[model samples]
Target: MSMAQWVETYGQGTVLAAGGVLIGLSFGFWAQRSRFCLRAAVIEFWHRRFGEKLSVWLLAFASAVIGVQLMVLMGWLDTGSARQISAKGSISGALIGGMLFGVGMVMTRGCASRLLVLSANGNLRALLSGLIFAVTAQAALGGALSPLRTHISSWWTVEGGAPRDLLAIAGVDHWAGLAMGGLWLAAALFFALRSPQRSVWMWLGGMGTGLSVAAAWGFSQWVAAESFDPVQIQGLTFSGPSAEWLMRVMHWPAPPIGFDFGLMPGVFVGSLIGALVGRDWKLEGFSDGYSMRRYIGGAILMGFGSMLAGGCAVGAGVTGGAIFALTAWLSLVGMWVGAGLTDRWLDGGAADKPTSLPAEGFKRP
Candidate 1:
């Protein structure tokens, strides 16, 4: 049956949730097998060791840009109404929040999405950090921290619509965007080929991770077009979704069953399956009180920073970057700089330092 028919039969919520499940599953599986982590990528780049980790991240990012731009050119997806473009943005928040998030990820040894993936693989440190991240995100969204986030966001505001669109600011069309993506893809291919540990999973997993982002965009747009009710055109984001799930679990009446409803669980399950298949599932926990404090502190910073910046690493960096959002680009730059500096200061520029829970399936060389 057609998507419209499915929506008519069941509901837009159910259909969106189902699509989220499929896309999230693909993302989780690929991210797990590829060991895709922006923190890892940033460390590799900063340490001047362009290896498998950096290549995988670049491939995923370039692929998402290419896929999303291609879809826009084909008239298959329209992102004009998406929040990343339509909503008011903050320069201060993007910069400050992105930096904080970068620092937090280095401290915790994973970003928000990475934390979730690791949690599903029996990493107790990640599991706890994920919970902390969710709670902090919730607090920033509507709790006590909301006021602080609001004040910072209001410090330097940018008008929505054309002002928030990076492509519009650059006087470039989607074709240019596609070309830029191509250049990035070329660089990724060069690095991937140079890496001695390149494998089929590296290629497929990186592309798959990126395609999942594009697929989410396309699916949500299609749903919005077909559904009678208003539906949010969104891709994968952990901050809002994490807060939503936390509230649902803590409250009585459940929130609406939209894309986020299934996305989290799907990712968790997908990562679990990947771990089992790869025999990478192993129970692990914090080694010391100092480590525990660091993880918690990182989670708190990430939670607040993601909300302040209007997205996390995946949300603002990859998803928003693909669409050429101005604030997202700033945030992405902030993350890279912040992470690099933090690594230099804290870890002494050692990217290969062992974490409390090393990414088991894929090791950094």
Candidate 2:
């Protein structure tokens, strides 16, 4: 059946929510299996150890870039109307917010998406941190912290369109973007082959995770085209979704069921299934008061930073980067730099050593 027919039968909200669930489920399953965390990759990069973590992240990122660019080249995709490209963006917000998020992820030992995935795998520490992160994200979105975010965002703003489109700014086309993705994929393959920790999941899961991002874009665009109702063309993102979920629980008049509405729950259930199948599910908590404080602090930073930056790691870093969004690239670079510096400062000489988590699968090498 056609998407329009499906929407007509099931309603636009239902169709969109179902699409979100499917996309989120795939993303969560692949991410959990691959243990794809930007925090681990950044740590490995800074420590000068190109290991499995770094390779997995590179593979996912390169795949997303390739997938998105390929669709654009084939005339099957249009990102021109996407908010990341069409909306006014902030340089100051991307830099500062990205750095803050990077620092927070290092402190928490996981990025926003990683935390959610781990939480689903029965990690109490992750569950708590995820809750705190959601709360803070809500606060930043429209709560007390909104003013600060607005102030920071206003420091330096760029008009949408050509200014935000990295491909346009570079004077290149989608083919150039696709070629860049190819180079990154080659580098990812080289690293993956050499890594001693290579495994089946690393290859399959990394690629799957990236492909999921592209699927989200395609699915949303298709739905928007077919549905008579105005539907947003969005990909995977956690910050706004988290905040939306939090509000749903606390306030009345629930928001309309959309992609974000189903995404969080879908990811949770998908991660749970992945964990059970992989026998990686485990309950864990803070070992000490200091550790608890660290997690909470990190959560707060991540929540606020993700909102300020307009996206979390996976949202802006991979999804937006694939579309060659200028702000997304800047935010990604800031994340890397901030993560590296924070790791060096916080861990010192032990930065190269793997920090074993309470759970077995989450260990950073």
Candidate 3:
């Protein structure tokens, strides 16, 4: 039976919640295995000669494109569910928020998802970063800075709706988009396969990482449809939900619980369980008082940026990109530029220097 039919026949909550569990498990397993991290990927690209981390991200992106396209073809998910398709005109927000998030990730030494997994590993620094991100995202989304974000976003627009996704832009059908996306995925795999530094499991981990986001999107759609609010579909991301949860005090008539909220909690818990199973759990904290200060500052910046941008790395970067959102592309550019600037600044204006090493116990691939 069709996915919608299945959902209708069974139950929306059951389907969505099950999808969330799938996503949580996928992410927990992939993260535990591959250590996929955007911050580490960017930093390694800038400082170290290692490109393996970056490769993982590309692999994930490619995998996501494939998974999402397949889902669309199967009629399980509408391709338009992506934020990029919906928020095509919000270029200003995407760029500004993306850049800020990139900088924050650099400062905190990890992206939102990475921070979640790291926190599970007993990294006090990551936990602090998550808290700071949660607080700052709250402020930016509904607190004092919300006005600025609203103003900036009002000034930008995208012609012809959101850019046709990879295939549509290329003037091709969904299958074509699938083909193109698959080609990229193949290229990433080829690169990984050829790399002496890469492992089979690492590549699988990367693919799993990307698919987890797709699962989240599918799950989110299921949740939205169940809630009778088809307009509010969204997949996994850290920024907005954290902000919403924080500002729940103000927005009475609380928004109904959806996939993002369910998945977010599931990820944290899944990671914790994964860590424990792997014998990696420990109570940890900042390296020093200075480190704590930097971590907090970074988290706050990330929170603000994510709020303005509408989602964090997973939200804007993965889910946004899959749908071929013009704003999401802008956000990606902003994130890269911001990350580059922050990396340079942290390395004494030289982007080539490695600012910090992997934590003491974590082994570098």
Candidate 4:
């Protein structure tokens, strides 16, 4: 029987939840092993040392682009039906929100994914930051800050009925996302492999993580299309999913859990397993009130920014960009610029602060 047919037989929730757990496990493992962080990747791309980290990201994105596109061609996913396809993601939101997210990641010394992994390793700071980020993101999505985000984005939003992705924006055929995906894959691979520092596991980590993203997309698509129950077609995103997961766990079915509910904790669980395997688990906490305050502020910024930008670093920068969304690319550029600025700002003010976390994943390499 086909995968969709099998999902139907097994039940959509069961299959989707299982698939989510599997992807989350693999993603958390790879993320921990390679110390993946998009902000760090951007910094290292310009600053060196962890150029390998940036290369890892490229490999992951490249692999994901090709894998997802192939699935599209094979009819596993109707690219157009995915949530981001027709939505003209707001240009203002992508720029401003991305900048805010970049700054927040820099201040907290990790993005959402990095913080999640760190939390698994017994970093209390990360745990707190995760909670703060979740709550603040929830607020932006549906609480206090929602109106502001909605208003600004509406003022600057692109109209519907245009080409769905950046490929079309750049004068390429939007429907030829697969072909364009190949070109992008080639570019990312070329740069990544060209790096002098090469490790087998790092490559495996990158490739594996990317394949997880691809598999998530395909699997989500299949279930959403084939299942009797309602499902949202999505892939690996951190911020919103993090909030959704937190609510379900805290509220316990007031609002039913969705695909992301399985994904969020699964990531933490998988990361914890990875830490155990690597013997990297450690007890870590804030250095002082000053440090704790910084984390809280940063988390709030990231939460709000992610909602405005339409996703977090992994959501917009990797997953959305993998499909060549214009908004994702725009958010990425804003992130690069924002991260650079934050680095400069932080460097001037606090050079002697005590480190509470291993910041190599988020720091200026």
Candidate 5:
């Protein structure tokens, strides 16, 4: 059956769910296998080692940018329809939220994607972190904290008008924008090769992650175009979808689940598969109450910050920025600065030492 006909018969939600599952599952598998962690990427850059890990992340972002632009060139996607693409941005929100999310990521020992992967590996601590992360995100987004969040986000919004990208700032056209995005991706590959010791597996994993994000855009666009009920054009993102999945679970008459909704569970399942294949599956937990306290605090901050900044590290920094949104870049800088400060604090004023990622970041035996 045709995509449009299939949507009519099985429901657009179903098609989207299926697409989300495939995308999320593949991404989760590669992420685990590659040990792709953005926090570690930043730390590597900070210490000036510029290792393979950071290169993987940059390559992923570049791949995503190239992929999305390819679809755009083909007229298969209109990236402007995505929520992350906007004429205005919350400058204060991006800075504050990015910093808070960064600190929270350090405390919880993982970003949104890493949390999903860890939970799949049977890390009970990650399970708790995921729960707190989801519930708090829901609260900040549409629950009790909505009023405060709305107030803060609206307090100092900046309106750039039309396009809302770096290309616009430079007064460039669509073709120039595409060229620039391509250059960014090429630059990422060049840097990846510069790393003294990057495994082929790491390179593949990073590229795979980018492909997932790019594929998500194509899938979303295809469905929206084919279906009578148009869906939002988007790529991979966890912060908002994490909350959406939670609400769907708690509600009796759940609202229609979007394509992105299926991604989290797919990631979980994919991570499980990766662990089983890699022989790294293991069950673990926190050492003490202090750690629990730290996790809760971190989750709360991450929830608030992600909502305010409009995304998490992967959501805002990689996926969104690759699509050419201006806020993504700002949020990324904020995350870098924030994570750096937290790393310094954890290092006990030994600011010169390289920051260490949490144990959860590793695929332990």
Candidate 6:
């Protein structure tokens, strides 16, 4: 093909990749600045009775809903681009997966994405979790459990032959869905605002979390629609991509790096750079072999759970929320419940404990 033709043919992947880079950078920066971790959110909420972290998470959800809804309304994206919303899947799997993921995150002291960023910051424990998460996720995606995932997903169906998203469940149009989602967002904001530490940074953190997912979705749609001469299209989420990258290195004939793959690496790299730039990079390890064991176990559960659930907090929680996917909501609730239970269990039935923020900070070299 001529140069012009080549540009026309290859431009989509390029644009999509660019968008992914933006999304990754934005999320890494925002997350680092805001200290937004779902495990931390739940822990702080229960222990300190502080809602800042929770509020940040809620804001992200609301922002994602609004951004994606607006994109759909503006014809920038088809709502179907969201996989968790449009794809057929088992609610039971999502719940089970989410619960497992939640418990694992608590045991590991971080979720999949959190582990990735933390590993980048030089947390050896997190590095171990990231490694296990990647392997288990791959196994679940196309390994021994793949059949189970497929079988269960195939058997489950929603009412009215509707899409598995929240809007469909409510029997509402896109606009109505957006409005309802916005209301939830508003409630999150209201609750956040009630916090004594209210500030612009907190609001931004919440909105950024949600917006990051919307951007990833839009970017995915753009890439998937684009025709690339030698490349494929993809979107965000940490679990599968991590494993895929490893597989690609070991086995040739792997698909070309796409938006999702690029974004995942970008988040890891971006966070590392951010930590270094902020002079926050440090190398750390587990306190003991027991801590190491718990971390690895947590990572394995998180990996398997994220695979079965169809995404991690960012993937299913924020991105799925943007599309109002019922499974996503279920997964989020399951994660929270699992996390709460894990925390309590860890504490030996002690219902009351002070919130434990990472004392060493999450920066790594």
| Count of steric clashes across candidates, in order | 0, 0, 1, 0, 0, 5
lDDT score at residue 106, model 3, on the 0-100 scale: 81
Point out where model 6 deviates above 4 Å: 1-15, 46-48, 151-161, 198-200, 224-235, 348-365
Candidate 2 residue-wise lDDT, 138-194, digit = tens: 999999999999999999999999999999999999999999999999999999999
Q: What is the TM-score of each candidate against the true structure?
A: 0.97, 0.97, 0.86, 0.89, 0.92, 0.87
Which one is best on lDDT?
1
Candidate 5 lDDT tens digits, 1-365: 88989899999899899999999999999888878888777766776657677778877877787787778878888877777665577877888889999898877877878888989988888889888988988999989988878888787777655545665777766676667667766766777788776687678888898888889989988999998865778778888889988888898787677787688889999989988988879898888898888888888888888888889888888788777777777888888888777866764433243333244654221
Q: Per-residue CA lDDT of candidate 3, range 104-129, in tens?
A: 88878788888888787788888778
> Which window of ten consecutive residues has the lowest lDDT sum in model 6?
356-365
Model 5 stretches with alpha carbons more than 4 Å out: 86-88, 160-163, 194-197, 348-358, 363-365
Please give the CA lDDT of all the candidate structures. Answer: 0.90, 0.89, 0.72, 0.77, 0.80, 0.72
Judge candidate 6 at residue 163 and give its lDDT.
54
Q: Which residue pairs overlap in candidate 6's backbone?
A: 60-206, 60-210, 121-364, 166-324, 282-364
Task: Show where candidate 1 strays beyond 4 Å.
Answer: 352-364
Worst 10 residues of 1 by lDDT: 355-364
Quick one: ranking by lDDT, best first? 1, 2, 5, 4, 6, 3
- Residue 202, candidate 1: how far off, in angstroms? 0.8
Give the lDDT of residue 100 in candidate 4.
Answer: 94
lDDT of 2 at 167: 90
Instruction: State candidate 6's TM-score.
Output: 0.87
lDDT of 2: 0.89
Alpha-carbon shift of residue 183 in model 3 (angstroms) = 3.3
User: How many clashing residue pairs, candidate 4?
Assistant: 0
Kindly give the stretch of ten consecutive residues in candidate 2 with the minimal lDDT sum: 356-365
